[model samples]
Target: MEEYAREPCPWRIVDDCGGAFTMGAIGGGVFQSVKGFRNAPVVSLKDSLLGFRHRLKGSANAVRLRAPQIGGSFAVWGGLFSTIDCGLVRIRGKEDPWNSITSGAMTGAVLAARSGPLAMVGSAMMGGILLALIEGFGILLTRYTTALEPRLALATYSSPDPLAPGHLQVHAR
Candidate 1:
């Protein structure tokens, strides 16, 4: 297990839940606002200003009312995902992208189980694919950053003399 993964399961769950909730709430608010604005009734040219104000107010209300619901759903998904991930780590005796992908698939399926088997299967596949993409991106990013480290070191500047600090030279490998 990684040093960071050593945290207690409950704490991980809570942390993931909180983070997911914040993401969902902000995203939901923006989505709801856009939806509300799009759906708001179109008023005549004479009432354009009033119509704009009405649309804004409507969008605000939609965000206020819907954001929390979206946040709660995201929290549930995060908590469940964290729990499954912790369990997988313990069972598999390793930490890797597979664990994350499996956890995401299971979480999605479990959450969608209420709807039907088809939905569950679809959700599981979707979740797994999504997680795979995320993990792949993360891996690529880490590699990209790691590859840059040597170049960064080589690109560092070195001053030739302490007396003349204004002049510096780049030493490239």
Candidate 2:
């Protein structure tokens, strides 16, 4: 019985080490969360850009879905481009979405400290309003700038080849 108990002690040590490694990974995850909150501006900018791209893609899809069947291949490509352009316009107004959170927090803190109770409440309200406005502005700007404009163009097949008989080759631009 004593030998068996001692034999498992080494295995227990290995298990403890594994537990410690997992704990370390969890701690790292927490650290990253904190860091992400702190770096909200950078993250917000990235998000705005991504949103713009998403909206642009949605616009392009809308065009492809709505286009009439009368046009030839050039017309199809032109229609796709026109739809993408509209999406770009929509996205351009939404850049810098995070700008308000970072800037508004600082501005709000300063105003809150400087003002009286009534003033503080008023300032806080104003801060909320300002933050919302800025966020809206950033989103619109990003959509127009990144999504609408052809920053990088690719010429992949927009539709399935009539010659090919399979569903896998049916591409949408």
Candidate 3:
């Protein structure tokens, strides 16, 4: 009960999303105002402020239009990645570049299909190659770090003694 009482409100995270609206307003307002002044160097401060207001309105509308695309992409990407990754690991007992690239391309194609049929193929190619490269980078990073400092390896990072409380233990070697 004490822990629950001390915990922060769950709505706090949702409230943070609202802050993006204000940030977008300010960003759009300032950007358009600056551009307007640049194009017409002799514009008055009042005119610039009015331009800012109009830009702010447009920016709010743009956000509304883009919300669906953004949300859809988030859902599709996460769902595809998790599903494909798990499937590959289950079958092969480990993930590899081939599986990563194939899964990435499939998901990318679906994502790009929203734009057009042609875009789907292109996006798949790009996504597959990019995912493979990313995986390669991860492998290299782990190997490099493990060689330079063995203690920083993945196995070393695991908690060695979960049964004991109040202290975290890791193997020395």
Candidate 4:
């Protein structure tokens, strides 16, 4: 029997953290830039050019200062979540969305524990729900694609020319 190659836990955690950090950094940069531009003061028409320059500068500064903070937060959250997920998989001896949802909830609760009991509960619920929705969507997408695959293959092999006589043209709506 050929054994399936799998990434070790440490490397998987590292990969998850690095990817999450990069995603967070880029997303934070764009969000902060837009927010800064929107909050920038609009001066009189006479100084519109100055206003524009101010907005540009403000946006750049926001990106420079806030992006790293947001990125670090995301990295921490991701690392903790991934670690929990790996641990759950090891304990349960299986892999599934339950692990992700549980991990997300635990990570959120852990991160928010310093805030208060209410905050921890709220964060845990929010995290679990969010992960559940994401996993549900993924499952739906996979099922839809799998269901379509045979039909798509049939369509492709049925006829070379759509306009030919007796050609069954499949229209996907």
Query: For model 3, what is the error of residue 164's alpha carbon versus the real structure, in angstroms, after optimal superposition?
Result: 40
lDDT of 1 by residue, 1-74 (tens): 12334567778888999999999999999999998887877675588889898888888889999999999999
lDDT of 4 by residue, 1-173 (tens): 23335577788789888888998999999999999888877765688889899899889989999999999989999899999999998999988889999999999999999999999999999999999999899889878988888778655335778688767756554
Instruction: Write down the RMSD of all candidates, one decimal each.
Output: 3.1, 28.8, 12.3, 3.9
| Weakest ten-residue segment in model 4 by summed lDDT | 1-10
lDDT of 4: 0.88
- Which tens-of-lDDT digit does each residue in 63-143 have in candidate 2? 343322212332433333233333343456442334344334444544466666666666656765777787788668767
- Candidate 1 vs. true structure, TM-score: 0.86
| TM-score result, candidate 4 | 0.85
Model 3, stretches more than 4 Å misplaced? 1-46, 109-121, 150-173
Q: Which residue pairs show collisions in model 1?
A: none
Candidate 1 accuracy as lDDT: 0.88
lDDT at residue 7 of model 2 (Cα atoms):
21
How displaced is residue 165 in candidate 3, in Å?
Answer: 41
> Candidate 4: which stretches are off by over 4 Å?
1-6, 42-45, 157-173
